[model samples]
Target chain A: MKILCNKADLLKGVSTVSKAVPSKTTMPILECILIDATSAVIKLTANDMDLGIQTEIKGTIVEKGMIAIDAKIFSEIVRKLPDSEISIETNDNLQTTITCEKAKFDLAGKSADEFSFLPKIEKDVSINISEFTLKEVIRQTLFSIADNETNKLMTGELFEFSGSTLRVVSLDGHRISIRKIELKEDVESKKLVVPGKTLSDITKIVSGEIDKDVVLSYTNNHIVFEFDNTTVVSRLIEGDYFKIDQMLSNDYETKVKINKREFLNSIDRATLFVKEGDKKPIILDIGEEAIELKIKSQIGSMDESINIEKEGKDLMIGFNPKFLIDALRVIDEDEVTLYLMNAKAPCFIKDEKENYIYLILPVNFNVGA
Target chain B: MKILCNKADLLKGVSTVSKAVPSKTTMPILECILIDATSAVIKLTANDMDLGIQTEIKGTIVEKGMIAIDAKIFSEIVRKLPDSEISIETNDNLQTTITCEKAKFDLAGKSADEFSFLPKIEKDVSINISEFTLKEVIRQTLFSIADNETNKLMTGELFEFSGSTLRVVSLDGHRISIRKIELKEDVESKKLVVPGKTLSDITKIVSGEIDKDVVLSYTNNHIVFEFDNTTVVSRLIEGDYFKIDQMLSNDYETKVKINKREFLNSIDRATLFVKEGDKKPIILDIGEEAIELKIKSQIGSMDESINIEKEGKDLMIGFNPKFLIDALRVIDEDEVTLYLMNAKAPCFIKDEKENYIYLILPVNFNVGA
Candidate 1:
């Protein structure tokens, strides 16, 4: 398509759409990004059957035409080119010449008819949330989703929307992360299971600052997110998600409060000596004034202590050191509170000042009274 | 060994020796660094049978002893500990405790006697060169060494140490880089083949000012480099290396000088569309004033041209753009001189004023003239 656009804006638009470009496609056309010049806007679209991204940028339309070019090659050349004005010239011979300053890339183009259509958003249920908040919730919870295909439904993060709150739950049957954020606009309660990879890719393009309210919509088979000048559509998983609330605990027999940094460092040291196989548990010996962490592996062992502001009956419990380290790193407050329900069962971990809770599925370890 | 060492010094020593420690070892003790404590100095050594590194640091020997610990674990713990005095205490049972600040790591230790002896210098002939110049020569030539283990001898850099100069040569049978520097201290003629990995690791740990001199010594089985408080010894490749000089042309038929940046960038752009197959050949069509670069791939194609000042007849050569890029990147001069003897012969690339010569074997292109 014949159009004039700022190299920076073109690069951003191409980068967002290129994420959906097929890395390895059976069909050749799936790797091409279709560029169309309509009025004063240049629209770029890329699709890989299941996921698609389309973005538009303001540009001067010289000749209203369209062409599909290799998404990866075009994006890479655009990124390396100077930031001056980029003039794209497309001809009926199916060739696009991108010229910038002293650099020019004449890339053979595909016919516009070869480009596939993006998934159409049939029913759009709009919701408003700050881009930063959405990204924060996704970052904390999406990574915990099951990547193995054996658990097909677990490959996606389960999103539960009700009233004014948006809750995201992801678990690989081992570790679980649940994050909830209050939305600005209310929508009909709906549960959508979106693939982890697609959501993570979309988050990359969305800036932390919410330039505009993100409009979310769900069709019969796909979920679409429209924000700024870009739109991303991802397929949804169809399955009955587990009742996550039932896994939460209410009572604890013993509690300990310690500085998050101090506890994390102590647990990190203990993990060094925690070996693989049968007897690799890290013993947490709790006293009136401090907690001692020790782990003995086949090669040797490690022991570190952190001061704790507590007064209780001396107790000792064994656990996987990595679990405590992970929970400590995610705690939002300076001081982390660990609620040990006899240390034999799953322990509830959270910040002393925040509502966040991280439940560790504890391994069976000997606890000496 | 029980010793109190400066955390910084101990960390540096461990880190340096660990570079020679291969992660996967058929012989188990190769993964451990032998720590020897003496009255005035503490030495750490790690060897993988082929190469070894030893660094002696001054420390207070509480009790003179020797023991070996897992290099990876020791390095990890030492790296994370705060900058302070770290006491490495080994008991009668061989259990080692590394304590720094509030963090402690107790690792299983083995007798230091299990480790292999360090390679010794056998030849008296040596050359003393400035660390800066030696480092420069190594950096410029090491990348050309063949990485494949098909021929063990070609995997190392070939060195020629004569009365007043030190020359380094490396080739992958396709591309060869040669760098020569005048030695500061007079020495007898000596030749040694040092493994590329040893020279590369030495470059990473190299310190001191440009005026500092490093001693190089060689023997039948090993080449040892002693600098500052560290000594690096690599097993020399047995047998003779391929004669790289014979592969380079003594004179040029067609020579042209071009700006290093301009030529490098042009070739980089041409690489985008260059596909290696039974199809189109990447063409460098040189005219009277500029060079037009073109590549045609099955997916698409790319064409770019840059202007240059030339006084010779027009020439068109088809060579792999990657080899040209590699040669161009090593040139320290602002302008690069490209010499072509013929289409079938190798191309010699060098700076307009430097003795460093890069030889790139030309690939046969079907679009052959």
Candidate 2:
């Protein structure tokens, strides 16, 4: 295989595919990036069993062949090479030579036949969404996904499509975050669970352009995202997601509307007094005109209040400050409303239209302790 | 103790002194910052046995007293507080109350008497240098200091004052770095070995302003640096420094003048083939008009060349790419002259006036291996 490509173009393609390259693997071949010039465009692919990324770059194909090169070394060399034309050639013995200006590198490449290729997905059912909207939805819900594999479904987010609305939901037993977006076209009802790691990697690859659209195609076992000359394929988590609808409630005994920035800042400050790995909860006392936030730990205690417009009866509730902070940070509105059914029920932070809902379970705490 | 200060001012002072607070120490008092309001200026001090820092912040003293607060918690609280005047009050029982805007914190403070204080240095011998110049000299020579305590003196830098010239030298056994600067006013000849950690911390505190001067005062055992309303006191390493004069040679059989940036870039690219903890050397083959750099490792091999203006007979030498890259990175010259005697002798990177000299010992290598 022989090809001549610009350093900038090659580096970008290498970096895009490198996201799926496993850092440590039992099979050494999984660490290699297959470079194929047989097609009109040079394609670079890296697969790590669960996730795979393939990107193409513009280059002149001197000879049509393929070779798998170590992703780490190839990327590093291309990154540091001069911003000029780079010539990559591979011999029959899989010895690849890279040359740019006055610098030259000779590396041992593995046979491309031994490399694992991404599973081809049949593009039967597909949906088109703007990159900006897709990235925003992922960012708003990805944080709530469970990091551990104890509950396989909790480690993945549920993507449900019905009518003209696409609803994304993620939870980790403690809290549930749901976001609903209007789709441009109507589609049949469908649901799939996507691993959090895959979505995290996809976010990095998308440019988040409002005009550019990403085509998402999914099969029974695999899902594919195609945009900007790059394609990402990830295996779907095979499990039924938790029925979060039962956990969400619309009835409330007390409701309050407060400035999002002020509430976020107060909760953030309260977090300073809570040490890591501690179960200290921030107690909120909703009164007539303001909500007093309190927390007491071994090191210190913090008490802060934010003015709020309240209705119904006043109530006191305790919650993990991190859950409240996470929901408030993603909200871009000037003010957010909070609804509480009672001290034992979960508190809901959502708009009247229910475009977004964040339900946080309350923790039992000694009042006025 | 009671004081009202702007949140920004308090945060700055806390951060400045927190550098001296050890992360883990047997003496808990060393992890606290003593807030002394007994004097006219509100001072915050932190000591870690070997190094101590004290800084004064502008604040109105409501009541004249002193208290000690945990550095980590105090800094975090002050950092998150609102940008307004913060009132800090301490009761007789060492319960400190800090209030800013609508937020308040009650922290347990330690006894001020238990906190360690910085050693007072008599300002009999002092030198005034612009913060920019001092910071530059330290940056240029600090990289050569040995990190390990195997050799007590090698872990420090020699600051020698002779007439109007102030020469600084530091070396690890393989290479030596020397930098000389002309002082504004003539002073008596003196010598002091300042610990690398002290100089490192001083660099972060200094603003590097050309108009601002940092007053450095030295005693028999301590060195004090006062600048920008901040004073840092550190214990100096006591021992005779190595005599690097013999290692620097003026004689040479082959000489080459090359662009500092180009040579540095070529050597840096060659470093890609070298693995961590590997002792692979970059071989330089000086020819009539260019120098070719070559390196071979188990992973791969790299060969690069840079055009140079050469003199005398051709010669080949090898050196650890890191040693050469370190010196080249710190030097500000566009073109540097290299003086080489033979493959066994050291290479000198300096000029005619010898304002800056870097002596690097070459490593033996097989010519065509």
DockQ-derived CAPRI band for the predicted complex in model 1: medium
Calculate DockQ per candidate and list them: 0.51, 0.90
The CA lDDT at A42 in model 1 is: 88
lDDT of 2 by residue, A1-369 (tens): 899999999999999999999999989899999998988889999999999999999989999999999999999999999899999999988999999999889999999899999898889878999999999999999999999989999999999999989999999988999999999999878899999999999999899999999998899898899999999999999978788787877899999999999999999999987888988899999999999999998889999988999999999999999999999989889999999989989999999999999999999998856
DockQ category of candidate 2: high
lDDT of 2 by residue, B1-369 (tens): 999999999999999998899999988898899999998989999999899999999999999999999999999999999899999999999999999999999999999889878887878878888999999999999999999999989999999998988999999999999999988898879888999998998898899999999988889898899999999999999978787786777889999999998899889988998898989999999999999999999889998889999999899999999999999999999999999989989999997899999999999999868
Candidate 1 off by > 4 Å: A82-85, A100-108, A122-125, A185-189, A210-213, A217-221, A274-279, A311-315, A352-354, A366-369, B122-126, B208-211, B240-250, B275-281
TM-score of every model versus the real structure: 0.91, 0.99
Q: Weakest 10 consecutive residues, lDDT, candidate 1 chain A?
A: A348-357
Calculate each model's fnat, 2 decimals.
0.60, 0.95
lDDT of 1: 0.79
